[model samples]
Target: MTDDTNCIEVVTLTPLAQRFSYRCRTPLPEPGCRVHVPFGRGERIAIVTGSSPCPEGVQIKDVRTVLDQQPLLPKALQALLEFGSNYYHYPLGGAWATALPARLCQGEPLPTPKPELWKLRSDATLPQSGWGLRQSELLQRLRRGNLRMTELGSGDRQRIRQFLAAGWIEAARESPRLHETPLTLRPEQQQAVAAIRAACGFQPFLLDGVTSSGKTEVYLQSMEPLLLAGKQVLLLVPEIALIGQTYERCVQRFGATAVAVYHSGQGDAERLRVWERARSGSLSILLGTRSALFVPLARPGLLIVDEEHDPSYKQQSGWLYSARDLGLRRAQLEELPIVLASATPALESLYNRQCGRYADLRLRERASAQNIPQIEILPLRKKRLLGGLDPSLLSACAETLASGQQALFFLNRRGYAPALLCHDCGHVPHCRRCSAPLTWHRRQARLRCHHCGWEAPVPQRCPSCGGDGMNGIGMGTEGLEQFLQERFPNIPILRVDRDEVHTPRQLAERLQAIRSTRPAILLGTQMLSKGHHFPDVTLVGIVDVDQGLYSADFRAGERLAQTVIQVAGRSGRGDAPGRVLLQSHLPEHPLLLALQSGDYGTAAAQLLRERQQAGLPPLRALALLQAEAQRVEPVYAFLHAAQEYFQGSLDCSGPVPALLERRAGFHRAYLWLESTSRPLLQQVLGASMPQIPSLPGARRVRWSLDVDPQNF
Candidate 1:
């Protein structure tokens, strides 16, 4: 017989077919609480998913402890996870792992954050006259009065450490709350704010604004009314690089105590603290990257997705999922208002707006009253270029720098050269693991694969012809940075790329340098675009943009348009009017011409028509069954099994090799299923997929299903 009172269902970070039933000493712990439950060899930390009935003849072990005062993930978020896991076709274990911080997964206790107070110790003697400048200055600051450590900035960490170690300072716990002055909203911004404030239940709004249109200010103002009502808000940005600046802006307006920033870059302890603030109902706002979507909210009143079109929102590896899609699902589940703000909104969101699923909020003018940058396309045909730099562009950059202003060179690609070619044999070095050419990185003095992160030292000569005719081909951010440095010797060139800025602190430092008011050049990959606010950068030059026009990927045009708009928007944010020089071999491409219209509405309409005709996403649903194995035959067999099972209902493509046929030594192939009817597609998946694992060749290879696949 089943012991209903003693049995509880627990979920761990394991790919289980279903939740396990465990015996508990007391009344089943709250459904969302963290419990230490016995697994194979040891105890594993797990979320108590729900109650269960003990099965006959089963020996279930008792849970050791309930680690939370309450459920870490509340009922609302739990419902969200359930829906997202099923929708994305991700395992419940992996989905939940993504929800909580790494520390919480190790069966450790989620701690309560103590109030931080620092005071000069009562037993400490006055420092002698021999103190160094750093110690001396720190002591002087401490002598003023007891200080709250929260008031300290980034520069104060080292000093605070020294003081605490020397017994010159002591910390005490104190409860605190905070407030800050709000910026005045313009008339149009007020209207947008009014609309957001009036949102009652399950409302989704698209804050469609141009660059420097003060959309952020609107986001802040809209949050104000909700914060005053003691409600929490979630603000999601596309990248970790943006979190520091956004955090600074939020802390300045809401006060540090009211705002919390969470991301993977943060240490486990720091992430846990942010989670504690969010869960305790003390934080008014939680701002961070995609994973921030899962942070538990006690009173989530609104959800805001900044740069909603960004590709980073889609997790390409390990339980591929889209945060933007989940955000909408969460809002609908909670019946809360959600505002997806984007200077260049995603086509999916645009399609929804066209179909009346989302209300559109537009901010057309620049917030500073500066005119949008005048864009001039410089054709790369038959022009005398100085190391890939058109003389005209250089002259403009010289003028901008001489006038004590900044110029930003935007290149989406990183490394020194995109490829290394053997002129003698016409051979190119390619990654052994992936079917892609290796890029030559000059600074690292190596050839690297951008796709799979494979790298090797540059060869002495061509491996094919042995002619010593190896030549660097194509331009990248490194090549642009080097050329700019040689031409503009006096001005400082700050190169911001993945290679240069690995941490958030590095990003913050580079941003700080740009704000110095000195004339300097900013060079980088897509990282320099969109998120940053560079006021004095009056001249913006896109060294390379021709590549995105005709990519194999269908989303290329939309992504390229967003990048162009965002990169150009970074300039002219200050009092000075900005100018953008775009270099392209094909100057009059329809997509490029459409950009002159300013907003993406016209281009979006065009793309939508094309997508509808072609039966793509937003008009149709897609699921990619990707299979990989050391040997390729099993992959094909497994996918063939899946295709045969779905048979006539869903249209399946491939069992063809992937774009990069082999990645990390595994040959990959994808089976794509598309359908105009979503329910029919879901029904087909629900009907026959459970039996595939036990089928022939299924165990010989690793495979996953990506529902609504964002990438190939």
Candidate 2:
């Protein structure tokens, strides 16, 4: 007989078929608690998912240890994980692993943040002679008022400890001070704020605003009511690079102690501390990147997704899931309101608004009173160009710089050039691992593969023909930077790309330089386009646009449109009027002409109609069964067999070669399953989870199921 009450279900941080049942002690631990249990030949840290009956005729081992006094994850977060696991067709173990920090997964105890405040003693005698430089500075600062330990420097820590022991200082537990000063909102912004504040439960609002249209201000003002009610708010950004800027803004509005920032860039200890503080309800406002969606909240009230249209929210690798989609699910589970704010809203979000599933909040005008940037298409046909720079565009840049304003050259490519071409044999270098060209990085004096991250020193002679005639072929950010620097020697040139900005600190420093330096030239890739406000940048010259106009991927047009509008929006954010020049070989392209009208709604509607006619996403559901291996045969064999096995109500496409046939030395192929009904698609995909793994040649190759895949 199965003992249902004494058995608990646990899941480890591995790709397993299902949860395992383990016999629990008399005092049962909660579902979200961590448990140490024995697996096949090893011990693993597993999460207690729920209670289950002991399987008949199975040897169930007893759990060795319960790591938490209370559930580590709250019930709301647990529900979100469960929904994501089933929706994305991912295992619970992998979902848990992706959601929590690495330290927590390794059985580390929850971090308790005990902040100490230090102040000078009232009756302490002066320490003039014996103290070192740091000690003297610390005492001098403490004479003013109390300071948090975090405010002290590393060298001052030892001196503070000594001073505490010597009765020269006193310490107490620190408390957060809430000093929220809400910005004065315009009428439209006030309307948006009111809509968010009036949300009773599980409401979704799409805050559709143009760049610099005060969407963030709406977020800040709406959060005030919730924060005052002693409820925590979660704000999810799309990038780690934006966390520093967003964190600074939040800290400035709500006191430093009230706001906390969490991301993967921080150390494990810091991440765990933030996680614990958030769960303990000590944090009022928590800001983070995509993964922060899983952070537990003791008193959840509202969820905000900034730049909701960004592709970064979709996890491209293991355990594929959409943070934005799951954010909505989390809000529903928590019975809270979620605001998805974006300038160029995602088509899915727009569709939802059209279907009346989401409330629409629009901020039509720029908050700064600056006019929308003027868009002009510069025809790149039969014009004398200087190293890919049209003379007219160069003149415009010079004019902007000469007028004491900044000009930006926006190119979505990085490195020096696309490939190193040999003149003697007309040979181009390609990545040894991927079937892609090697990019030439001039400053590094190396050839790099953007796809696989492989690099090699620039060769003196062509590998195909022993001739010394290799040169870069196409223009990239580095090449454009060099070309502009040579032409405008007097102006300061700043390049913002992955190569130049590796960390958030570096990106912050570069942004600071752009703000402080006038009459500067900024050159960068798409990293520069994500809601960065460059006030003095009056001119934006799009150096490249044709590459993205036509692609095998259906989302290419939408992505290109978003990029163009976002890059153009960076201009005219300051006092001066702004202008954008798009250099395109095909100026009459319908997409460009639609962008020229500056009506994204109309363009999006047209695209939606086309999608409806074509039976794409937001109209129909899609699930991609991806298979890859070092060899081609196994991948095709496994996918073909699985395709045959899955043949049923849903329409099944070919197990065709992937967009990139070979990447990182793996031969990739995919099968697309589509249905008009989402529930039906989910049903079909959910059924294949276990059966497909046992398909022919499945063990010889790696395979995964991507539900609502963003990439092909």
Clashing residue pairs in candidate 2, if any? Answer: none
Model 1 lDDT per residue over 1-712, tens place: 6576899888887666578888988767887788888788887888888887788888888888878767878788889888887777666877888888888888678786554667788898766777887677667777887667667776676778877787777865222233566677778898999999999999999999988888888988888878877899999998998888788877887777678888888889899888877886767889989989999887889999999989899998786889998999999989999999888898899988988999989988888868887668889999989878789999999999998999999988888889999999999999988878999999889999988898999998999988899989988888888888899888999999998998888888888988994799999988899878898999999888888888766778878888888898888899888989999899888877877655567777787888889888889988888899988888999889878866797998878788778888899998889898988888888765677688678899998888887676
Question: Where does model 2 exceed 4 Å of error?
Answer: 1-4, 115-181
> What is the lDDT of every predicted structure here?
0.84, 0.88
Q: Count the backbone clashes (under 3 Å) in each candidate.
A: 0, 0
Which stretches of model 1 miss by more than 4 angstroms? 115-181
Question: Please, what is the TM-score per model?
Answer: 0.90, 0.92
> In model 1, where is the ten-residue run with the lowest total lDDT?
171-180
> Cα lDDT for residue 479, model 2?
92
lDDT of 2 by residue, 313-424 (tens): 9999888999999999999988999999998999999999999999999988997778777689999999888979889999999899999999999999998898999999
